[model samples]
Target: MEMSELTALLTPEGLRLLDALGTVETTDAAARAVSTLRAAGHGPDLVAAVVGQAHLRAKARTKFGEFASRMLFTRAGLEQATRLSVAARHAGRLRTAGITHVADLGCGIGGDSLAFAGAGLRVTAVDADEITAALTAFNLAPFGDDATVLHSTAETADLTGIDAVWLDPARRTAGHSETRRVAATDYSPSLDWAFDLATRMPVGIKLGPGHDRDQLPAESEAQWVSVDGSVVELVLWSGALARPGVHRAAMVVRGGHTHELTAPADSEDAPVRELGAFLHEPDGAVIRARLIGDVARHLEAGMLDEHIAYLTSDAALTSPFVQSFRVREVLPVTPKAISAALRAGEIGTLEIKKRGVDIDPATFRKKLTLRGPNAATLILARVGSKRHAILADRVDAA
Candidate 1:
């Protein structure tokens, strides 16, 4: 079936069939939904979500599960995958911003919406797809009447007395391609329109982490958020929600690790401290937010390079964004030099880490035949034009 046909089938009939037969409490709903779509001879890829959604409804063993049902999942959601922790990261930002109420624009199956409610915030979840809206309503039912699920495009969604708006615009192009071809203006209307609507209320927009930095507003806080060390989504928070020039924030969700860094508004010099034999790389969010100065003070270290985000310290610093390693041996960045050291110590397996270097870790490892038991050393070398490798053991010191 064509894309338009698949979209049409998701209305009235498809929703009714799903509602009538999807109330079961098990993953078997997946098979049943697939059976229905197969019987209809619909595009298998098109209905794959229907199948997974069926399973999801049945898998609602927790309060959060009930909330996830209202969200709309795209092909990317399936491919890149969404988890409870990841969704909670976005919801946490809402809570941190002092938002007591939310308008969950494009609420896919209500995953993040549910999280907001679970975090004790009221929600108005909206979706253009009828089936998705129905699922959202059903999932949001446990939030009591405080949460409202609407069947409307983000453009027409009522925004009366809303505390905040969150939009995850569809980024995928037609034809199931991962790349987005729709111009910002082609988003049913335009991102500018969405931003205007948001300016009327507090708003948070979720975009691909690879989104163009040039297009972001001057006053917005563009945050590149990562959960468990992996960068997930780039978030745009308007001044309506948080004051402008709020240096971007990098949040590491797991372990509840957070580091706030801020640069001078006038681009003043970042105070450099002494290099204490160890360097730490701040998380992307911290670097983007220009919070390196604060991070340096937090770590009690100075900049190894005036502009680099790396922090150097001798005293063991316990920051989540920075890793601590003890330099076992500092050697030149050459195959022969590295090989000699590795063999002398009988270092067998090498964990190669390089920065500002062109040497491939795999190629370097293969050439060295890195073999040795027990401890290891770091090799510092310029891959092309700079010296930037540090061989170290994962020690307690920073």
Candidate 2:
């Protein structure tokens, strides 16, 4: 939003209107609201701002939950903001470290700052983007002086007496509705500066889970977090924030359950063996943290392929770190042969998963005409030097 548009929306009349409008979940509802507001003689800027925020609030629910209702957001800000649950976890870490005041550098939409203040820590939330800073101030307005929102670059923000720091450097070009990835060298606050600050005090830096593991600092603890199977972020912790005897960690959160796997160093790969009664797919965070070996050992499983992440074992075991599947039978590798086998079983619903294979699951699914009431999972994997097609059933842990 433009500065002038934001100026019109910060007033009492505008926020009340936004609250009254609620969320516009559909394009038709959005158009109706815009027309009604325009008919009521509201200025174009105020109408646009309220309508846009209403739309954003609807979209923000997935990340911010109910709190999104009272918060203002830009499209890009909402996209980059950390999920509330994850932010709260970060806040707990700082609190456990005995940090009283923390500086959140490049605080996009104040996600971490909100968590910090809510966890009873004083926060200095700084952002280089003027509009994002203003929205953050509004989001954290409830905390009053406990949360200080600043419209300044992280490099220029005064640290003063802060005990801990959180850095979320911009990895994309500045934008509102659309953004593209930029080279990490162009990141605001620079990795060099952020890493340097970590040496003096506890610091946490958030990066994409797929970030180059080789480029990570040797002195920090890297934690890969996955929510509901998707690997979300890789956080590097330094100083007291870094746990002792832990250089690599994987935090998997599914629904209300949370599990963590940590190791002092990269784990060795489990020995490869032939397919057994059950197959296991390590969670994305486990794969990213290179801790699959630990999970495999826990389940008494071995790698199905020397290079692939899939695991297999004769024992019927499962854990939060892996999605377990019961191997039904080995099927023919060709799509036509697979289709014939699927049709013979009257399987209508199929979940196709592929690894170390060149086939597109979607296109291959279309090739098979499913018509029965049965449902099954199809795993296409490369075992040793051979490609194998296996029918499997998802194991529901008891």
Best by lDDT: 2
Per-residue accuracy of model 2 over 1-398 as CA lDDT, tens digit each: 88888999999999999999999998888999999999999999999999999999999999889999999999899898899999999998998989999999999888889999999999999999899999999999999999999999988889889898999999999977789888878887788898898888899999999998998999899999999999989999999899998999999999857889999999998999889999999999999999989989999999998899999999999999999999988987887888888888899999999999999999888888787999999999988778899999999753
Off by over 4 Å in 1: 1-74, 78-83, 86-100, 130-135, 174-189, 243-245, 256-276, 306-308, 375-384, 395-398
- Which 10 successive residues of model 2 have the least lDDT summed? 175-184
lDDT of model 1, residue 20: 53
Q: Which stretches of candidate 2 lie over 4 Å from their true place?
A: none
Q: Quote model 2's TM-score.
A: 0.98
| lDDT computed for candidate 2 | 0.92
Count of clashing pairs, candidate 1: 23
Question: lDDT of each prediction vs. the true structure?
Answer: 0.63, 0.92
Provide the lDDT at 237 for model 1.
78
